[model samples]
Target: MKKQELIHLHGLLAQVQNHYEEETGNDVEHDEYASVSVRPTSIHMSKDDHKDAVFALAAGITSELADEATEQVPAAAD
Candidate 1:
């Protein structure tokens, strides 16, 4: 993906994190992403940097959500 696309994805993920936290009253521990020090608006940063940040952010968000999904929910017709 292009750098612009990656940046856009990063922004979207950030929004997702915010929404999840606000709704669940839990925080997404994105220490790795924080350590990367790259935000979606950090357009001055390199594409690789944004890529790394995106990976870290995605991993953190997914990992947290996965933990919450440990219990299987029954599949039922609505």
Candidate 2:
């Protein structure tokens, strides 16, 4: 991956992690959204789903970064 892609990926990962932390975060042992028990379940965010969400988040952030980069580029002096 290119440097821009890597930076965008990192930023997206951080944003998703932060959102998750906010959603089910507290001084508790375990939250259902973030549970890890060996048992049959049907309602849970699977690994693949989580990765997909991360990817989506990363894409959005990358677009924003690209926009900002474009705005920052100095125009040629005419």
Candidate 3:
């Protein structure tokens, strides 16, 4: 995953975990089949995204930022 996407996903997952911890007072870990997870996993892009829209949205936003960054670079010629 891209840097921005990783950061975004981490933050969102953290939020989910924190909330779950507060509510259930348990580990609140997502199983292997979980859609969105705070922890890393082994899977394809579409598979993971299909499992979790929150993950997909974060990844999409980060991708948009990356694309914008590429366009923001200044040309060398005057």
Name the candidate that leads on TM-score.
1
Candidate 3 lDDT by residue in tens digits, 8-43:
565565566566557756554344325443243323
Q: Which stretches of candidate 2 lie over 4 Å from their true place?
A: 1-43, 72-78
**What TM-scores do the predictions have?**
0.88, 0.40, 0.34
**Deviation from native of the Cα of residue 75 in model 3, angstroms:** 70
Is 1 or 2 the stronger prediction by TM-score? 1
Q: Which residue pairs in model 3 clash with each other? A: none
Residue 77 in model 3: shift from native, Å?
78
User: Candidate 3's C-alpha lDDT?
Assistant: 0.50
Candidate 1 residue lDDT tens string, 1-78: 999999999999999999999999989997899999999999999999999999999999999999889968889998
Each candidate's lDDT (Cα)? 0.95, 0.45, 0.50
- The residue-by-residue lDDT of candidate 2 on 1-78, one tens digit each, is 543444455455655546655764622212332332211122243544444444555554455456556876666988
lDDT, candidate 1, residue 7?
96
Best by lDDT: 1
Once model 3 is optimally superposed onto the true structure by TM-score, how far is the C-alpha of residue 2 displaced, in angstroms? Answer: 1.9
